[model samples]
Structures are given as structure tokens and as C-alpha cells.
Target: MAPPVEPDALPSPFAGLPGALWLYRFDAAGRAHVLDATQCGIDAVHAPDHWHWLHLDLSDARSAQVAAKLPLPDDARATLLSPDSHVNLQLDEDEAVHGAFVDWAHQRGVDLAVEGQLRGDDGIGWLHFALTPDLLVTARRQALRSVEAARRAVGAGTRADSPVRMLELIAGRFADTVERSGDGLSVRLDRIEDRVLADSIGEERRDLAQLRHQTVRLHRPLTAMRRVLKQFEQRHPAYPEHELLPAVARLNQRFDDLDGDVATLQERARLLQDEVAAKLAERTNRHLYVLSMVTALLLPPSLVAGLFGMNLPGLPFAHSTHGLAFALLLGVASSVVVYLALRRMGVSRST
Candidate 1:
């Protein structure tokens, strides 16, 4: 029997090697057992029937050192260590599959009380994985929702009979997060729509713009992931016989559907923004028209008062004892006439 893991000698799971986070060995029956670094001997890992998984935090220097010693293929090693690696999947000539994927990371302080409501902004991160028939390695620079969910599932005795199944589970977790985000976005859009209908659009334009940006961010990464999965389905050596191929294909389709939904939502937001602008312009034009009519009505009275106020030698109203009354009457008559003319011309009609 193997020696028991000693708490004093083992490093803390959260703060060890630059990127070494967790390790596990899963047997043929889909049961997982946590393994210490000291237990991951090369001879044991190389056993034809052995299956193991190592999760590392790539931001740690010790993780890089540990990764360099692993039996990963050259391409997989390079991809794992490269900081600029993007979301992609490549099948190496040695039958190894490796790639990076974008995953959602919940922001700190976000309120999770509501089922689909996310506070602040949605966070995004990357997860890299290298897979062989007998081994699976995963690395990340930051914590990811999907990875954590998979870990929790494993601990709960979820069946992951092979490395490929593990990958599928992780992918499915990502899909779930995206789906939830979409649902949240839909709820937000519905509220915005109500505001738009009521003509109470205040800061909703900014809100819609933010939603559009988030959708675009989500769409791009999902598109890349779908393309990678499609390529894997068509070209990877383990195509038809690979039990996980169908799962991969399903994931690809789901992302495609999500891409379409996001695109539609984005377009709807843009349309709503346009409508708000047009309504504002129309309202402004009506206000300006009303102001111009008021100015016209007051023009005649102002001119009349100015003429009478002047100290001209022979002013008609100046010689009359009832000059003030006569002037007031004239101004009122002029204003009424102007108002009538405006109404007749249809300038006062509501749009």
C-alpha cells in the first residue's frame, strides 16, 4: 500500500507551485483519488492502463518547472507556457490533443441571490488543457467557473471514465455559464424594452450599449471554440471511434445556437438605441417649434411698446389722456391676431 499523505510535508493546495493547484488520479471505474506531487512518479504515469489529471496555476514559476518535467508533447508544452496563447485546439502528430478555452470568472462582490442576475460586469478567463488517452493536464492563470464546477462534480463522484469525458464535462460547464449569461441578458433587454415603450429612456441607451459590448465579447470566444470543436471532429485521428466525438459535436452546435442568439440580441439593442435617438430628435423639434411661435406672438407687442416709449415730438398716443389704456388694448389685439394666424396655418397642430 502507498504511504499516507502527510499534512506537514504537503503544500497548501491554494498557495503552492506558481501554478500547481490540484492533482487527481481516476481509475477505469470513474472514481477519482487526489494525488500529491510526490506520488506522480513517471513509471506509474506511464503505465498503459493508468489515467491521471493534473491542474496547475500557470502563473506560478513552480508550475512551469513541474510542467517541463511532465511527458507532454512538444507542442502541448509550448502552448501551456506561452502567455499569448489564444482559444484553439490542435491535434499533434503524436496523437495528443491540446488547446486553450475562454471561461467565465465571477467577479468579486457580485450578488448571486438571483438565479441569472450578475452584478458589475461578466469576467472572462482562459483554461488550457493537454490530453492523451491516459493523462489529462489543465492549467490556468486565474480561477474559472467551469473548472471549479468540474472539480466539485469530480469530488461528488460524477463519472468521468476517460480524459476525453473530463474535457467534455469542462466544456459543458462553460456552455452552462454562457447559457445563464444569455438568460440574464434577456431579462435586462425586456426591462429596457418596457422603458422604451413608455418613452422613458433615460440612461437605457448606455445600458443597451454595455449589453451589446458584453454580447460581442461572448460571441467571439464562443465562435472560436465552436470552430475548434468542428475541426477536431473532422480532422482528429480519434474521430468516429472516439466516444467523446458526439459530445463535442453537440457542444459545437450549442455554441452555434448561442452565437445566433447573441447576434440577434445585439442587433435588437442597436435598433432600440436608434429608436430612442429618433424620438428625442422629434421631441426636440416640437419644443423648438413651440418656442418659435411664442417669439412671433410677442414680436408685435414689443415693437409697439418701443415706438410709443420713444420721445418723438408728434407721437399719436402721447397726446391722448388714455394713452396707456389704448396702448395695452392694441398690444392685446395684435397678440390675438398672431395667435389666430398661427392656428390657421396648422403650425399649432400636434404631430
Candidate 2:
């Protein structure tokens, strides 16, 4: 047997590489064993039939150093250390696959570009990864939710003999989080629809707006991911022979379905938004109708008061002893006449 592993040893060739976070190895029997810390050389770790995975934090200052020390192909290494957040997968001439993917993550002072997070509104993070036959490497500026969940699953003895399989597992975990979010949106839609039917959308316009925004955020990245994966599959179907096709196909199908669901939610929100606008317009029209009727009724009385208040020499009520009473009666009669005319014309009738 090999010597007992040291807990404090770092994956070596470069001393004190702080970016390295987690390391795992699969033996010839294909079981995952967490290598807490290792001083092992990359070549020694990659001997004959073993598979290894190293996860790193690119937010750390040693990102370049760690990428340089990786045994991955140059293109794969570049992908792992790239600070740009755009998603793409490329197959290197050496048969390594590398890409950046959008992943959900909580924020904590990451030293990376803005696009890496979930549109800067949600905690969406980018996961940059590269995979070879015997090794898988993933680096990210911020901590990702799916990456951590995959670690948990591995701790629970999840078996993935290949880097492709591990990648699939991490993607599946991400889909699980997305499914929960979609289900929540559906539930919220049901409540919104109920309120719409009951005519009690007190603050639901604003709520629905937030829902639509979240759906858009989820939709845009998912679309780019699905589109790029499909394009990669169609164009470069031969390289990475054993694993790439099925993995891309599976991810494409899963994300396509998810993108469809988000699109549906967006459509539903649009329709509800229109309905809310119509409802608000109808309410405004009713209030305006009431106000116009009140104004029409008061118009004649206002005219009578204005005419009486003008201090002209030959004002009709000015010489009468009962001038004040006559003026008051005239104003009341004018208002009543206006009210009767409006009633007769059906202007006061409820719709």
C-alpha cells in the first residue's frame, strides 16, 4: 500500500498554491476517494488508469500559477483561468474539452468580472472547467451552488468514473436548483392568476414584474447554453470520442425543456400584464366618469355664484330686500336643473 496521506500537504510542483480547494481521485476500481491534501506530482497522480479531479478558486491571486501547473492542454488551461463570462465549449486537438458555464452561486466579495454572477441581480456564477480522459479541472471566481452540491454528493459516495460523468452530475445538480425555482414561479403564477380572477391584485403588478424579470434572467443564459452545446455537438461530433456526444445531447435536451418552461412563464406574465393594464384603465375610466358628472352638476351653481358676486350697478338681485334668499334659491334651482338634465340624458346611469 502507498504511504498514509497527509492532511496538510498541497498538490505540488508549485509550493503554496492557495487556489487549489478540493481534490479527489478514482482508483482502478473506479471509486472516489477524497484526497484532502496531496504533495503528489501531476504526472504521478495521472499514472496509468487513474482519474483525478481538482477544483480551484480563480478569485484567489494564484489563479495563473495554478493554471500553469495544471497538466491540462493549453486551451483547456486557458479556459479554466479566463476571466470572461461568456459560455462556450471547445474541443482541443489534444482531445480535451473546455468551457465556461453559467452556474448559480451566493455572493461573497469575488475578485472577478461582473458577468460571472447571476446577471448581477441573482447570485448566478460562472463555472469554468476542462476535462480530459484522466483528469477534470474546474475553476470559479465565486463559490457556486452546484459545485458545492456535487462535493456533497461525492462525500456521500456518488460514483463517477469519468470526468464527463462528473460534469454531468454537476450539471444535473444545477438543473435540480433550476427546477425548484421554476416550480416556485409556477406556484406564484397560480396565486397571481387567482388574484386576477378574484379582482384583488393589490400589489400584484409589481410582483408579476419581478417574476418576469427573474424568468428572463433564467431564460437568457439557458438559451445561450443550449444553443452553444447544440452547435458544438453538430460541428465537432467526433472528438472526445467516447463521452462528448451523449453528454452534450443530454444537457441540450434538459436545458431545452427548461428553457421552454421559462418561456411559457414569460408568456403568461405578459398576458397578465396586459390584463392588469386593461383593469387599471377600466378603473380609471370609471373614476373619471364620476368626476365629470360631479363637475357638470356643480357648473351651473358655480356660474350663478360668480354672476351674483360681481358688483355691477344694475345687478338684478342687488335692489331686492330678499337678495340673499333669491340668490341662494337661484343657485339651488340651477344645480337641480343640471342634475335633472344629466339624469334624463342617462349620463348618470351605471354601466
Number of the top TM-score candidate: 1
- Candidate 1 C-alpha lDDT tens digits along 1-351: 999998656644433233557777887788888766554543445555558888888877678776776789989988777775467877776668788888877554443334343334567788888888888889888777778778878988998888888988998878876778778888899899899899997898789889888777777778889888887788865556665577677888898988888788888888988988898888899999889988989998998898889988988778789999999889889999989988999877768
- Tell me the deviation in Å of residue 73 in model 2: 1.8
Q: Which window of ten consecutive residues has the lowest lDDT sum in model 1?
A: 110-119
Error of 1 at 142 (Å): 1.9
Native-referenced Cα lDDT, model 1:
0.78
Question: Best lDDT goes to which candidate?
Answer: 2
Error of 2 at 294 (Å): 0.5
Query: What TM-score would every model get versus the actual structure?
Result: 0.85, 0.84
lDDT of each: 0.78, 0.81
The collision pairs in model 2 are 118-124
Collision pairs in model 1? 18-60, 19-57
lDDT of 2 by residue, 1-351 (tens): 988888546444455445778888887666788775435444444657789888888877775776676778887888888888888888877778899888888555643232232333556789999999888899998888778778878877888888889998898877776766787888889899899889886898998999898888788878888989889988885664668778988999999999899899999999998998889888889999989988988888899999989988898879889999998899889989988888899988857
Return the TM-score for candidate 2, rounded to 2 decimals: 0.84
